[model samples]
Target: MKIDGSALIAARQKLRANFPGRGEIGSPSIGTQEWLAEQAHVSIRALQYLERGEGSLSNLKKVCTALGISQWQQLIINYGEDYVSCIANRFVDFRPSIYPPENPETFANSSLLMTLDPLTLLVAKGKFETILLQEVNATLTGLAEPITYTWLAEVSLTPNGQGWLGWVKEVEPMNLLANDVPMNVPIMFKQLCVPQVSWGAFVDAVENLTTSQLNIEVCLIFQNFTKKFKVYVSVDLLKILFNEGRNKYLSPLPYRAQLKAIV
Candidate 1:
């Protein structure tokens, strides 16, 4: 898939939103483009090239890494034939506000329909805060019946300490995303207590787990990355990930992140 200019601009703005300052959003402690170039181990113009979506894949990855973009896919526009061309009706909503709203829904994921799929969310909020993300396995809760999901991994990040959380279960796998690559990645992050597992575990774990419902909150960011997005996962939809065998699932998205805030 090719990185579009709009993705580049979106990534830049997302990165900027991660920096801290005073009042309003926060202060920008990351400093100038020169500093960003230094951080990403690229030249000034190379950083510029990337910000303009005109850089090598290596440069883009480097910039993405330095900026703490967990969902680097958000920086690129297309993923072959799987891109969602038309927005589906906004079918899902998170109650109790999983996170504070920011940026006035400028990006595609902001659209309720766009976010409904289990795609990577590049969540950043405060400067020197934490970046938390999740491959949201979204399902409309009230579509038919009430489904209880077994929650997995809930840990604290901030001192005040809200935790990022998810639920796991076994069922006939379904595609949360139409795109193959993002769908079947063995999506997991390193944590102290919980063992990492692939998304494909559903092929086994669905049978492995006797029931569907366990809940835990976990830290989503380590240092400064991004804020958080409020979301709710439904247990009624037991979906498997995309491209489990095609890609190692480690190359693109991040492995290390901690919770900045969550509820």
Candidate 2:
């Protein structure tokens, strides 16, 4: 994953110039190059190379931390625009609108897609995974019959050091209410090891959950890691169930995130 060098340099200069110094913070701030080098604990040459977008990922990470940049995604989100060619499509593939027109005659409305915040799973270092299970509880009151529904999550995992990788075991569609059955379909289950790149799996369990169809719980379990972590995204489909598909057009996209460990 690459970042815009010019953006990095601009951010660094702006921050360094505005940093508290002398009477402002009761201590004098050092020169830009020297201060950044000391804070990041790296050579001045290394910082210069990174400012030009010609440094290693390790050095970039260090400098970014020194600049109060908590996550790499921050750089991409703040500076990813106008430098799309330098970054991967999977890392920054986001749009404000993906809704179809009103007339169903032109659009089949077979599928809807969404992108969430980048996910990082910290399996080592004792960092716990952030679990978010959102249940779409809506009724299909006004729509055509035989409404078969399906879902899928496309994810990408990049490990940091020698961390062992883990994958999505299975997706269970449960009845959030009483003992009501969500849909006519059976249980949805699948298992596969996720590679470094993107991998997508569809939940072929329920066609239609009627009114009680809700709750899709997915658990990502990480075993162990020394200095490894994982980062990825969750791409979900938007199949609005109530109010004549008005909910899908309400928001840009639903957001969900996963975290990684740093042990």
Candidate 3:
């Protein structure tokens, strides 16, 4: 499998520029190759090979992790869309369902209740559905702890012409589905609020992009993470959720072209 060394180098350089000081995990300054190699646990030689487009995919992934590049697929510039599709189909999975969990009381104490009405309206009107990424791991670049982030990605289309809207809210496994959720699940206990701007742009892209694009930019929202980074999601996965959601829910009103948020 061929790699795009230029793309890899660009991403690495961008990370170095964005984070210029010493990194966590006892690593050296982020600007140096040796520091990156240490963070990725790859030999400096292997890193060099990768920058030249000659390393294995395993090494590429490690480099991606160290560079804060959540999805290695973003670095594969020469690999055509088909390659991305193949990878997306094989690895990405979407678990879609209705929002406002069956147990509403569990979230009664949550401070986000006020912002949920728009979501509730969509669900009640059969216009909203959520996709859960299950367990996603993310670490703040300067922080020591690597948190397992779990999100319930809320999605809804805006009338037909207005495009789509979305919000990714943090969920606590215990309060989320305490009764049926297993203890071994990777859902986080801490709730970090997602910024409106971040998730808004994500769904907006989804609405405008073609399936060939395959990947969508997703934000990793952490309370203390100063820098905002992205996680690439397979567009196909979201399509799966949309298809399933549309078929699962039936609206009673005559199909209207216009939909409005309950503000």
Candidate 4:
């Protein structure tokens, strides 16, 4: 994705917002560009470029790490009002709010749940397959479902002769559960099933899960029928789930072992 220049500028403003004396150029504690350059192991020229929001991702990550911050989001929030306002305005335009009065008709359906199919789920799982799994697991538990699933396709396995089609029955949700929860409690299950098991049926089933918030327990199954099916998920959903303590289940043991073996 192309970097947002305005956001980058605002992020810089946010980073320097609280410097002593409103970011006086000579404040010793604030650290000079030269000092930051040396600390980050980057050239002075590179540091200058980064300050101007023209640096590469590697340089940006290094500088951000040295400065003890997360991503550029923090920078935008910490900067002055201008930075915050710019981001707010940009986001509003990007994803405008639908307040009741302004969007009464929309509000009528606000509580409606949207169901997603396998392809939709895959798309939503994109960079956050882990988050997607956690959400799926949480949904299952909350609804008292009896099965859970981990897509073998994600691990690059083909469907044939008990290869990717084999389901890891009674796969433990122990790892997926919140640590605060008592381990002895009978964990709920969501019947784990894969689309390829009944490709047409799987698509419809996923759609149902996505649309409704009903409590129902069902067996989960997995099967691989196709050799070339791919899905993508949204980054925002992943971030939301990650923030809401649903980051577990993104990768299960079998997948991890497969990754390790490949490496």
Candidate 5:
């Protein structure tokens, strides 16, 4: 999966030569190192390494993406066998199937997620049960009209102790699902779960039954939100709200503070 240095250099040179007025490897405009770095989603320094034909498999793929080359392996063919590298195609052999709704299940990877307004849910008219709640309620706690904000929540059902427990992380805008309506404030979520359920009715008894991350192999995917999908979030981080962030968790919320400190 990794690219040979000579191959990358040669490929880049060929691409540059195709452009009008393109001269050097790091010339002005499209040929600039900075521009290429942006396209590859790497830093200026990383681009320097890329030009030398040295980078990890992930970076090589990024470079391929920037250069608009679909056959990433082709980059290696030009480098001669000495620089050519290969890795097992694990994804081709393993992809989890969607779970049946008749029984509960969990997933092995993450999927895309987004926030929704309860009022919007009302208008949409679907089956939305409050599965799990933390310190705050899923609906606004009696906030009058012009209720600009509400808590983002995680809901789920546990059947026989082997149910789907989802893990989520809000993804960046560029990582949003292709061609989906981007969210407003706090947007899309990357969810990880298993194909445990499909179109099955949830027993009222399990509505409040808290599900744990037990007996489940996770599956991940970056998906757009649909009326059919449900949201599952960590209790501590689900306080995502617009402008005034659910207001239930005080300012400098634990999650926000931790994120800021890390960043």
Candidate 6:
């Protein structure tokens, strides 16, 4: 979706509102611009242009680096509502520039790659799938470790079709029954298997399987599931996912014990 001009204006207003006494909308640190310019080896005018939102992407990156900020998303959030949607949209489809010297290659495997686009669509549509495919892609790509493994117990839908049936079929050799009811005659069951299935694994599986097919609808499901079972998954995974959305979804303190155990 296109970034609205009015939203940009509102964003600027919000930034200005945050520092009513400053006589200008800019970073809170006094002389921060000059300091950043000096550290980045850029002219003070260029740094001023950035603070005024008139600087180019290169200058902005340099200033952000000099200021010790790793991602621009934080700055965007600080800008407020006008940039919120735009930032959210970007988060969903973020593909880091390979040409940028500081860009990390590992970033390509982040949940951000999948969550951003579908999430933006979800914001626009207000409905999205429960599963996110990009998460699955990352797992499949071996960026993160698996959480669990389980045998596929059943399947009854058309092969390769969308919906639950498609999901079951993809991991076939398993039987998906409507319920635990037994048929008049005993039915034979095949052994279908899924490996590395954790909350992350499940999310990644659903995401990788249905990203193009399901889009934002998948993210809605993912968001709901994550909230419901926050305690079930590793805190690090939760942090990673939240970071992808450019939001803090988990409490860092609560996970200290768990992280210690994992380490």
lDDT winner: 3
State the weakest 10-residue window (summed lDDT) of model 1: 254-263
State how far residue 86 of model 4 sits from its true place (Å): 26
TM-score of 1: 0.28
lDDT of model 4, residue 18:
57
Kindly list the per-residue Cα lDDT of model 1 for residues 75-177, writing each as its tens digit: 4533222222222122221211122123212211221111122223222222212222322222222222222222122222224434222323312222233
Per-model TM values vs. the true structure? 0.28, 0.26, 0.28, 0.25, 0.25, 0.21
Model 2's TM-score against the true structure: 0.26
Q: Give the Cα error of residue 180 in candidate 6, in Å.
A: 31
Q: For candidate 3, write residues 23-122 as lDDT tens digits.
A: 6666666656778788788998998888887788889998888777664653553332221110111122222111224423332222221111121101
The local distance difference test score of model 1 is 0.35
Residue range 147-176, candidate 5, lDDT tens digits = 121223332212432233221332222222
Candidate 4 per-residue C-alpha lDDT over 16-85 given as tens digits, one digit per residue, 9 for 90 to 100: 5655343344433344554456567788787676665466767766666666646443232112211110
Best by TM-score: 3
The positional error of residue 217 in candidate 6, measured at the CA in angstroms, is 19
Over 1-263, each residue of candidate 6 has an lDDT whose tens digit, in order, gives: 11122322343345445545433344433334444456777897876555555656576666566655453332331222221121122212212212112323333322221211111211221122122211211112222333221212123223353432222332222211223232221111121123312222334443344222222211111211211111112334434553443333232111111111110
**Backbone Cα, N, C clashes tallied per candidate:** 39, 12, 0, 34, 24, 26
lDDT for position 126 in model 6: 19
Model 4's C-alpha root-mean-square deviation from the true structure amounts to 20.6
- Cα lDDT tens digits for candidate 2, 1-263: 34556656766677767765532343336437667777888998988877765667788888888777664433332231221111112222211111234333322222322222232221111112221122211111122322222223322233521211122222343212212222221111222213211111111211233432222222322111012122232222222222223354452222211222111
Worst 10 residues of 4 by lDDT: 85-94
Each model's lDDT: 0.35, 0.34, 0.39, 0.30, 0.32, 0.30
